[model samples]
Target: MKLHQLEALVASADAGSIRGAARSLGLSQAAVTRALRELEANERLPLLIRAPEGITFTEHGKVLLTHARIVLNQLEHAHNDLERLRGRVEGSLTVGVTPWITLTFLAEAVRLFRERMPDIRLELVEGLMAVAQPLLRDGSMDFAVGQLQPGASELEFASEAVLTYESSVMVREGHRKVRARSIRELLDEDWVLNFAPDGKRDLVDYLFTRHGAQIDERRIVRAQSVATLQTMVEQADMCTWSPTILSHVPPFGGRLRSLALREAFEPRQLGIVTRRNSTLSRAAVAFIDCLLQVIRRHARSAKKEDLALFKTLELLI
Candidate 1:
């Protein structure tokens, strides 16, 4: 089928109707319908069913739409590559990052990247791996920076471990439970936790199980935003497990303190994740370099206590 026909099909699927697709593509509704009909005629199968409400794809249409998206994504990538070959990094770059990384080094990396490639558009999405993975697989994101979980190597993505960092149980400063010596002793207090499919939730549960304590789901408030977690810890008698870097940053740095739990878990590996076998744009490569540089510089000038803590946790830099 013609490229225009594929474009019509994909755009209509995205917009939910031929008229909406025409508006998006700056074409007439009749033209969009004609292109879609031509595609169906060529395939000798009904692609979509038009209705007053909108349009619904047939089973065969659903399969074709998936391939159409991949083709369109590849075409866009080719255009970006051509621009890069002309010695200009002037295309859009979408990146996904975990909250801790966003707070620690992502802002600085973005600033430096903008300075070097001012014409390039940058989109930053902050969330957990469960949210970012789908975007990466669907060609909606260029790359991601976050924690690498167990069994990551089995996935269809390439991951490069940059550093390993420790996590701690944090509580409001001067809270009565700050001096609690054991995990079981702090179980009475409510907990604010990051809500991930199998990431932070699993870690919290593992901590309780390892300490021979049953997890009290009723006392847990699951959240994904760092700001919400901080507000809850500051205003309520609640605690959370956070990256050591977060405990060293503002609002949290002075307002929160880590509990001295008797049991210590292994440090988590932080890194970059990208779709395997995909060609990256020059802007994406440059941004990844910028991130690594910032992390290395921060590691070098880190405070002695911070270095000692990383060493104590057996973290790799």
Candidate 2:
């Protein structure tokens, strides 16, 4: 079938109606209908079942739609590759980043990248790995910077470690309880937890279980935004465990204090994750290089007090 035919099918599937696809593709309703009919005729199968509500794909159409998306993505990549071959770093780069990275080096990297290649457009997708992984696999995201779990090695992606940091239990400055000393000591404290439904919750559960502490579900407040979490901690008697890097930054730097805990938690790995067997654009590579440079510089310029804190956490460069 023609590429336009495949495009029509994919667009229709995404839009859930032929008229919607027509509007999106800048084609008339009759043109979209004709294209769909031609595609089905060529394949000798009914691809879509029309209904009053919308359109639904047949079993065969569902399988074809999957491959159609991949094929369309490959075609787009081919165009990008050709542009790169011409030594043009003027294209779009989409990157997924966790909040920690965004708050740290991402802004600086974006600024540097813009100065180097002003023609290239950069799009940043902020979310956890669970939301970003699918986008990466489907060729929607070029690369991602986030926490890489141990199980990530089993996935069909390649990752390179950028930084390692320990998680710290934090509270507002000058709390009544000076320090926890141990996880068990903080069992009765109100906690502000990450809203992301992932290993973070599991990690907290594991720590509480290992320390023989019962987690009071009623005392737990789930929040995803860093600003919201900071507000909760500053205004209430709530505690949270966050990446140590945040403790050195503003808002948390003076307003919040990391509790001295005798028990150690495992250090988390931050890294760049990219799809395996996919070619990265020159722009994406340049952006990552800029990010690494910023990170290295930040590490080098860290104050003695921050260095001491990093050493205490056993963070490896």
Candidate 3:
């Protein structure tokens, strides 16, 4: 099947409707439908189940959709690389970011990168670190910045550190629990924990688990993003762990009163990661340099902000 057919297939899977897929690719609905047919014929599998509301992928269709997306992303990047070979530093670069970084530092990096390379197509995919690693391996992403959990081998080190920062219990200002100086005093208070699919929640969980404190899982106000968790904490008697770096922001710092988590509630490491044993394009290398420069400048200017981090040498080093 043609690349356009695969592109159309992937788009259809993404948008869940022929009309929506057409809009995304700037193609007519009939054209997208025809392309999907062509892909289905080539694969000899029904790729979609049409419904009134939207389409759903059949079992085989889901497999094909996954393969189709990987192929289309690579083909698009290949086309971009061809353009770059002619001295145009232009191509799509998709990066995976964790929710925590997505809320804070990513905005600054995106702002600076766009100014320098406006033509470089950018895609930011945000999810848990576990979900992002395979995309990095399959060439769907050029780089990623997130926390590294145990046994994540696909992600090679670009530049990262044990980025140390104090943990704070985020609560509304003037809340009674805010008066607690230590986590011990606040133990009986309600907690809004960021629920992990498996494993511990945060640095607080790590410390408490190590010290044999039972994490009251029932007290958790499970949330996927910091904003949502913060919102719940603001409205209710629950509190969440807010990294000190985030507390620097005015609205977060002002509206949310932070009580110390205890001495053991040290900082978690935030690493800049890429696929292991993978080669980066020239443009990708340049973009990584730009990202590092941004980080270095931020580190230098905000030395007080830099709590305790292990700065490994550059990836090129």
Candidate 4:
């Protein structure tokens, strides 16, 4: 279908109605309706059903909307690239950031990025790689920054590790298990850890299996985001497995502490994830540079063993 037609469809779906789409696109509602009708005629299928509540996509419409968004997003990237190449600092950028990044150095990076490219529109999505994968694949996000786990290569994404550090078991300031030194000591404790679809990758399994003990699945809580995990740890009698650097930052530094267990877990590699074949726009590159700058600056003053991971930062970008 034509670009305008696809834009009309995507805009309608995004805005939830033809009127809203017309307003966003600065066109008349009748023109938007005609464009949608023409798009349906070109495809020989009904795309949207208009109702009082708004619009709903048909099966065919749903399928087209996926590709439509990717196409539109790629076109925007191309436009941004050309503008930057011509010495114009203007465009949009969407970067997915995990909780650790969002709570730590992201604010400084954004400030730096804004100073360098004030005209660019910056959008930050706080989520894990699991949440970011589809968005990155569909071109809704340019890249993601977080802890890269094993098997990430199988997802057809490229990653660049900036910091290498171990994950830690965290507890609230006055937690009963605060003095416990090993995984075995945590069996009876109420734990809040991340979820993995497979049993082998699950943190509960890892903690117990390593100690040759049975998992206390009944007392465990599975959380999707580190933010949620930290909240539970701080406000309740729950301990969570988190990045080592998580407890070293502000607010959390006062609210929580790393368990300092005698046992070791897999090293958490913090990095940037992007679609395998995707070319980052100029804005993406500039934003990442600012992030690295912040990391380097922070490393100079970081005192904790975990926070010092930035000193060993390796850039594969």
Residue-pair clashes per candidate, as listed? 0, 0, 0, 0
Q: For candidate 2, lDDT tens digit of each residue in 1-317?
A: 89999899989988999999999999999999999999999999998999989999999898788668767776776787688689865578889998777766678899998998788777899876766777777667888987644465337678777767777888888876656687778878888867446565566665676667777778778786778889888888788878766777665777778878876777778778887677777777888889888776766666785474455333234
lDDT of 4 by residue, 198-276 (tens): 5334565567776676765878887887767877888877978777666666667668878877777766677888877
After superposing candidate 3, which stretches have Cα over 4 Å from the reference? 1-5, 15-47, 50-54, 96-108, 123-142, 149-173, 179-184, 195-208, 254-258, 261-263, 274-284, 302-317
Q: Tell me the lDDT of model 2 at 21.
A: 99
Which candidate model has the greater lDDT, 1 or 2?
A: 1
TM-score of each: 0.84, 0.82, 0.70, 0.82
TM-score of 3: 0.70
Q: Which stretches of candidate 1 lie over 4 Å from their true place?
A: 1-6, 34-50, 56-70, 149-154, 198-201, 302-317
Assess candidate 4 and give its lDDT: 0.80
Q: In candidate 1, what are the lDDT values of residues 182-235, reduced to their tens digit?
A: 889878889998755656556666778767887677888887687888889988
Root-mean-square deviation of candidate 4? 3.4
lDDT of each: 0.80, 0.78, 0.67, 0.80
lDDT of 3 by residue, 131-182 (tens): 6766765557876777666543634534355244445566777788777765
Best by lDDT: 4
CA RMSD of all predictions: 3.3, 3.6, 5.1, 3.4
